[model samples]
Target: MNNTLLPAVDTNLVPVYAEIFLLIAASAILLIDLYLKGSRRNVTYYLSLLAVVGCAVLTFGDFNSGATVYTFNGMYVSDPMSNLLKLFTYVAVALTLVYSRQYVTDRGMLSGNLGGEFYVLALFAMLGQMIMISGNSMLSVYLGLELMSLSLYALVALRRDHATSTEAAMKYFILGALASGFMLYGISMIYGATGSLNIPDIAASAASGAADPTILVFGLVFMVSGMAFKLGAAPFHMWAPDVYQGSPTAVTLLLGGAPKLAAFAIVMRLLVEALPSLAYDWQQMLLVLAVLSLAIGNLTAIAQTNLKRMLAYSTIAQMGFVLLGMMAGVVGDDTSNMPAAYSAAMYSSITYVLTTLGSFGIIMMLARAGFEAEQIADFKGLGRRSPWFALVMTVLMFSLAGVPPMMGFMAKWAVLQAVANTGAVWLAVVAVMFSLIGAFYYLRVVKTMWFDEAVDTSPIVTPTDMRVALSLNGVAVVVLGLIPGALLGACLQAIEMTLRS
Candidate 1:
């Protein structure tokens, strides 16, 4: 009943202005496609790229103090946390376009059907992600999440004539719908209990130092279950492999990257911001999800013959590492250790996105007409035939497997150390053991490329744009792996901003 106690509802919208600009540009792309027709398709690409650069510039200008900036009557927020994630999403999507468009075009996935739809859909997806990042209320989070999910469903089925592509899209749509339902139901329950959807309001209400045990605990479980499925965690990971395998390689690349950052932001916003009083309950739930994800992801990846499917499982395992850091941060008895643990978790997320995108870049490189190159057998003797590609692939696989001197290794070390420091040594131990099991599958890719006999396969023609993009993507992983300080610093800065509030 006390309006004055609620969070402020007026602040500068400058931070999220980039999202607005992107919306305009996306509409322009679609219009251009409709009017100009066939020959001017390339114009859409150029405009999309320009929009991305513009958004990046806006994001750069937006970063400043760690103040919580309410926009649109407390529905949105703009702080260092949201800004950092928005910048990352921008960069990731830009890179995806640069690398993926040429492949999509080459495969006839972009012809005869409003060539700009992909760009438009991508913009909508980015909009959703931006909203999720700055969402101060449950309504905003769900709206943004649905926007992103709907765009992705259409994106996966862009090549509608293909049976596999349609199937993958359908599976994703069904699973996503279920996850959304769970999240919505949980939000309703929370609203019924507290009569509020604003995160800070929920926190303030619970800050009297106690929570309604049953309602809070069940709501937390439902929330976590929904987020786990979104992040492709175990027991909810069945869709990932099939979707990755069946979709076009370009779609798979998008599926594996940027949206993950959105997922992380949503979870942090809901759990840490809204339900701080119920930390102990969520901690145990996350630990179970993490353990199961690590076990299922690692053990199942070894048997996968398809590269896309293997990477899907690998993503599940990586999600476990993210959860491990989150759980450690929450469960740690020493409050002093929380910052470091959370930073580790956030850093792992950034590194995982970069490494996974780069790995998928390689797969996209080998993909050509009538030859999807989805199978690991396709990679046999790749080292002998294409030494440079093999070399890059080797680094990506090693990085994913958490091998030494790579960013993945550093990320794992950071999280596992935090888990150990929290006195969760058993969880840490299990993580390490599964990491080794995960390594075996990554090494198998290496073995096929290097040790196996070279096949007499036909020469695959690669587009110059894709070739250049793949090279940059692949090299970026190794370069970042060698010097992860910048990304790590960004992660720490973002985490500090989020928690210091």
Candidate 2:
């Protein structure tokens, strides 16, 4: 092997320094946490939040306003899309730590029993997501995926004493490993055919009809299958419910929340960016996946008695809507509308993550010592006990149901509009129908909270900081629902910038 270094002047490290800072910060936190004992470990917790916030600031400051620029020999990249996604990721993660703080502390995660591993590992996972978001090449994408997956696998089993948590961790690790293998095999096939792992080169080869169609399509199959598992889409979604149900609520939120943004980025790279020439082929596959996801996710969610498990299924259905918007971009080589299509999906992805973050935040808030708060029955008297939280949960439920007067409605509407624009009316219709079906379960939760009598009669007490954060998080959902133009435009602009590059 030839050992060579790229020109110093040509390497653009400026754009990726946020991720580097995250790596250093996480390492420093790990070392600092080692010396802290008991509740004093809250210092590590605070530092984790600070680290995430600092990364957000760094990402914002370094947001490139120009075209795509490659760094690290073109393995890493900077673009408006990545910049915007990274910003959102930071927000999701910071908010996650806020919501999870009391929950973990109550559960012994902060008392030196679980050590500071949760915070440290979360920071590391955040780094992985940042890596995945900016990855420009196959090798980089694989690296990011493994890093994020490995962190999540550990997080699920953070409560090692719990049999369910340990079982969930094992299931997730096995499934995740298999998915990774599939993705790697697909990458190898593409590399074999194109002789390059760079996204742009693979795209060029496909566009020029230089790569063998059979090989390209076969690789795409494995790639999409792998992506389906990561995104928790149906037929490949077996791991989500078990993992969501068995993991601690705080860890569950981390698994379900910010990672969706990275998953969307992975899809964008693998499908939209690297293989636009094969859009027609993959679009059909996505269509099937979307329909199955909507059907299985919604109908199955209706049967789930567990709140976390229901949300797991809801995540699947929500991802279906995202896929609906994504596959609408390519209609017989007319890629002019690709930005709107991709951006609509991006908007949906971001909205779903934000809404899910708040919903799970509330779930964690409801939980107390020795109580997991994982059941629909647990929310029976939420309205009587905590009207503010009940209302917040209501907003999230309505949003997830795609009901009017909530951000979720606008998200679904935007994606449907994008799909309709591409002449996919049937797809939009299927989505709406499943969305209506999905509404039943969300409405059921609302009914339980507002109308049913108390099951436990426990008071919901939360910290001032958590209360304030939850209020702001809920308010953002409502405000964004009412005025989604700015965010919608931002999404469009980011994708437009990417398309230009």
Candidate 3:
């Protein structure tokens, strides 16, 4: 008898404790929520928040350990970058649930047949984001992307009775599917060229010039295009405005926030980590996309009368800065500046998500039962209505405009500095000019809030928790701007450690 003995597989679940915990917690929450009725739904909300906190606690230990760990047969990784991004993702999800509580309740999104599906879907979406952040292989990244995208699609269409919401969801779903198809085709091409689906193996193959160059370049192009669509960069950003304007404000917040961080993580994974040999090609593409995004996003935002649509365009412009940072990472194979440049990009994404959450939170706060305060005109004389929140809105607008003493300014400065360090002065100059143009629209909102006459003089009633959270959100932006060294240092360390590992 010739018996063949197979080698034992080594499996470590420690690297993915947070993800596993989140998955189990979210599933349990979904089942537990069904038994809760009426106002008891608050129990589900609190449970979801607890799940996020538990995930954060689970992740913090790994992050503090400052060690790179891989598990699942090299298909998953737990690194400084992933840990940091996951922490931020948890914070973003928690804040979204908090700020959205009253808004969703008023819109009937959390009641009746929906029955806490919003919370369940959000937790699931967050789980998907965590997976994406830690994904070490193409297959894992794609799986995580689809999971997150599917959850978001459902969230967008949560208001099944609303025609506009349904339309937006359809657009998002179709475009998202197409983007995923592009990415999958690209992954297949890459696998064909390199004979590997593992990111590090692909990197080695590409670096050694063992991969087929023609097929690899084509795959990179398609993948970058897919990444651009996910980031809402121009030319691929058609669905953003429609979806942002049509979905419930709370849903918009969910869409615009943590997903950006996850998207940034995958961009780093696929482009920088897996295909550094083709940096020049992808850098050129990012440069063009960045310029187009800035020109289109800033110029078009000026014409938008809908606040949500305007913010959507603003998101596009902000992503341009991030792309610029990514593009600046490698200049003619001099990779010394990569960590700094990519860290700047990371900082830009995190700050943008923070500012967006506050902006949307204010929008939701203004919305009452049966009325969506979506129009730009709705902000007229908001200063007279609620001076505190109006001040918060002004701070948020200033930050988005890249005004000094706000986090956005520091983020833009960091990106521009990184670009300049690479001798790309022209790119930095163009970014600044476009930013100047962008400031007009943001300031216009401030003017509307503080200068325009009061159309509705009703008091803005908000839950104490949201009020406190929004205030802290706004304050953090300013404080971070004034002293950005800590966050910037953390980002730099995270990127450096990630690349080293």
Top-scoring candidate (TM-score): 3
Q: Sort the predicted structures by lDDT, highest score first.
A: 3, 2, 1
TM-score of each: 0.95, 0.97, 0.99
- Residue 268 of candidate 3: its Cα lDDT? 98
Q: Candidate 2's residue-wise lDDT over 3-65, tens digit each?
A: 466445556678788988899999999888888998698798899999998898888875645
Clashing pairs in 3: none
Query: In candidate 1, what are the lDDT values of residues 174-229, reduced to their tens digit?
Result: 99899999988888888777778998888777666444667866777778888888
Error of 2 at 338 (Å): 0.7
Off by over 4 Å in 2: 1-9, 64-67
Query: Worst ten-residue run, lDDT, model 1?
Result: 329-338
Provide the lDDT at 414 for model 3: 96
TM-score of 1: 0.95
Q: State the number of backbone clashes in model 3.
A: 0
Q: After superposition, how far is residue 390 of candidate 2 from its true place, in Å?
A: 0.5
Query: Which of the predicted structures, 1 or 2, would earn the higher lDDT when compared with the native?
Result: 2
Q: Residue 251's C-alpha lDDT in candidate 3?
A: 91
